[model samples]
Each structure stands twice: as C-alpha cells, then as structure tokens.
Target: MTKFGKIIRRLQGDESGAALVEVAITIPLVLLLSAGVFEFSNVLNTRLLLEAGVEDAARYMARCSGDWDTCKGFAQNLAANGAVSSGSARVAGWLPGTVEITKISKDATDTATGVQLYLSTKATVDVVDVSTDYTYQDLGFMSYLGFSNFTLSVSHQERVIGW
Candidate 1:
C-alpha cells in the first residue's frame, strides 16, 4: 500500500476519541433532565406552602365571629402571610389583596354541588373558603422544557361553627 493509504487505515482503526465523542453528545441531555426535575420540585414546594396558608386562614374563619368585613380582612392577611396581621408573605409575589375569603351557605333542601361537598360527612353548617391565585417565578430552567411562568391556585374550605 502507498503511504497515504497506510495513514488512512491507521486513523480509521484508532478508537481513542470514541468515549469523548459519546460523553460530549450525552452531557447536554443529562443536564437538561436534571434542570427540569429541579424546576418541578420548586414549583411543587411553592404550591404546598400556598395551600397551607389558605388552610390556616379557612380554619381561623370557621370559628371567628364579629364584623364580616373585619373577619374577611383578617382571613386575607392570614392567607397571604400565615398571620392575622400584616407580615411577609409565605411565598414571594403573594399579596393580601390576592386572597379571597368567601362564605357559602346551604339551604335545608339545597342540592347544589358546592353545598353538598360535605354530604358524606353529614356536615350541615355553613362553610368558609379561603383561596388565592399566585404567579410562580421560576429560575429560568423551565424555559428549556417549553414551560413559562404559570399561575398556581390554592384553596381550602372549613365548616363554619360561628353564627
């Protein structure tokens, strides 16, 4: 064989760069998957925190009495910050104004789905619903997975025992 033919055959038989090429191709995929998992966990954690705040507020309103406006204001503060007074929100970007405190009553013969939520438990009293809508702020990792900033909605309902 000629000199060029020998050189071509030798280069073709060499497998030294094979592992490097494989690693280079797979690194980006691994990184993307890891980032996606981290983003999902962060979003889930925020949702849990928001739900806890709403639950606390609903429980508080279930036993509270007095002025309707005052109770609602206090519930809003509690739902937003986990406190009945003004304080830092449990989740960033959450505000007291975003919290909604609603009272739902059931008639003796009402068959509405909302009122029948506790039918299995035989609860016949009124209910207090504490809810909030929050926009989640991500660390820019979710953009790679085709997800943008999304809204999280959290709510809790408690049976009211106060007249």
Candidate 2:
C-alpha cells in the first residue's frame, strides 16, 4: 500500500481523542445549564420571601384596625425583615413610591323588629397595599451571557377586619 493510503487507514482507525473532543463540546453546555438553574433558584427563593413578607403584613393589618401611618410602618418593617431572610446580599432595599394605603366605606341597611330600616351610617374599611422592589445581581457567567441586574416587584393587599 502507498504511504498516503496507510496514513488514511491509521487516521480512520484512531479513536483515542474522541472522548476528549466530546467532553470539550459538552462541558460548557453542562456548566451553562447549571448556572441557569442556580440563578433561577435564587430568583424563586427571593419571590417566595417577598410573598411571605407581604402576607404577614396584610394579616397584621387585617387583624388590627389602625391608621394609614401605622400600617405603613408595619409594612416597612416586614419588608426589611424579608430582605434579610431571603439571603440575597445584593438587594439594596425596597423601592420608594410603591407603598400605598387606601380607605373604603360602604353604606348598608339593617333589619330590626321585622322591618327594614336605613341606618344612615357607613362602615369604614382600611385596605393596606404593599409593594416592594428587589434587585438581583447576576453572576459573572450570566453577565457574559448578556444578562444584567434585574428588579423583582411584589405586591399584596389586605382589608382591615374587626373594625
């Protein structure tokens, strides 16, 4: 056989570097998937924390009838506590101009002595609306993939009870 034919045969039979080539191609894809999973988990955890905080504040407001200022203070405290518990170090703080509280009232009739009478009175309901924005600092890998810092906004509302 000619030298060229022998060289071709040897090259075709050589499988020594096949595993290395496959690993080189798949390693980066595995790493990218792992990073994505990690980032998604972080986002999910932060969202859950925010939801818990909001729910707690709402329940507090519902149980205790208070003025707008008092409810606002409670919401702020809950938001800060949530940030600490979420484990995201990059969260700067809750965004301003997002917290809101509104009061509502409605009039209704009452029945007494087998007669319906207009009470001419209104019942007041206090609604607490809380919204918080949190910033997440992406990992270097994510940044390289064109992802930047993003904000997650969470909001909740509750009506005052036992008022």
Candidate 3:
C-alpha cells in the first residue's frame, strides 16, 4: 500500500478523541445555560421582593389618616422593613435613598343611589403614590456575559380610606 493510503486508513480508524472533542464543545454550552438559569431566578426573586415591599407601603399609606410627613415616614419605614423581611440584604440603603412619596388631592365620588354624588364637597380624598428605584447587581457568573447591573423601578398608589 502506498504511504498516503496507509495514512488515510489510520485517520479513518481513529475514534479515540471523538468523545473528548464532543465534551469540549458541550461543556461550555451547559455551563452557560446553568448560569443563565441562576441569573434569571435571582432577578425574578428581587422583583417579587420589591413588589411585596411596595405593596406593603401602599397598603399602610392607604389606611393611615395621619399627617403627610408622618404618613411618608411610616411608608418609608414599612418598605425598608419589608425589604429586609424579604431576605434581601442589599435593600436597606436602596430603599431610603430611592424612595419617593407624592400626595395628591382627588375628588371622591359616591354612587350608592344610582347617581354619582361628589363626596369631595364634604371632605377631600388624598391619594399617595410611592415609588422606589433599585439596582440589581449580577452576582458573578452573569458578569462574565457582560451583565453587570440593571435598574428596576417599582411604584404603587393607594387612596386614603379615612372618613
């Protein structure tokens, strides 16, 4: 047999490195998938926690009949506490620094007798808007994919139910 033919036969029979090559190609893909799953889960959890905090603050403000400054302080405190309770250690500073409270006077309407009556003629209804901005920092693996930080803004509004 010619030397070239022998070399071709040897190359055709070589299967020893196939598994290694396959593993080398698939390992990186699997790792990337795992990292993506982890990062996504983290982001989802953070969002849920933020939602819970905002909801808590809104509910508190809605039920509070206190002065504007007192109500704002209460809402801020409640939101900070809620964040801590939600298992996010980084939310403490973020809440106070980013929390925004706005109060608006709105006309109340009553429709108990098949007719709309303006209740604000007697007393005004106050609505409180609470909003906060948060930054989510990628733990580690996601940083490798050029994801470092993301901004999340959450807000909730509720009317004061005081009579």
Q: Write the per-residue lDDT of candidate 1 for residues 56-133, one digit (tens) a residue.
A: 889888989877789888988888887899777799888888988899875434566554445434545588888888
- Output the TM-score of candidate 1: 0.81
RMSD to the true structure for each prediction, in A, is: 3.7, 6.9, 4.7
Question: For model 3, where is the 10-residue window of minimal lDDT?
Answer: 83-92
Q: Between the candidate structures 1 and 2, which one is better when assessed by TM-score?
A: 1
Candidate 2 Cα errors over 4 Å, as ranges: 1-5, 82-125
**Candidates ranked by TM-score, best first?**
1, 3, 2
Which structure among the candidates has the greatest TM-score?
Answer: 1
lDDT of 2 by residue, 26-118 (tens): 999999899899988877877787677667666665665566566566655655554313333223454323434344443233323533232
Off by over 4 Å in 3: 1-5, 83-93, 107-124
Candidate that would win on lDDT: 1
- Prediction-by-prediction clash tally: 0, 0, 0
Q: Per-residue lDDT tens digits of candidate 3, residues 72-140?
A: 776776776653233333354465546787877755655455443334554557787888888887778
| TM-score result, candidate 2 | 0.69
lDDT of 3 at 12: 100
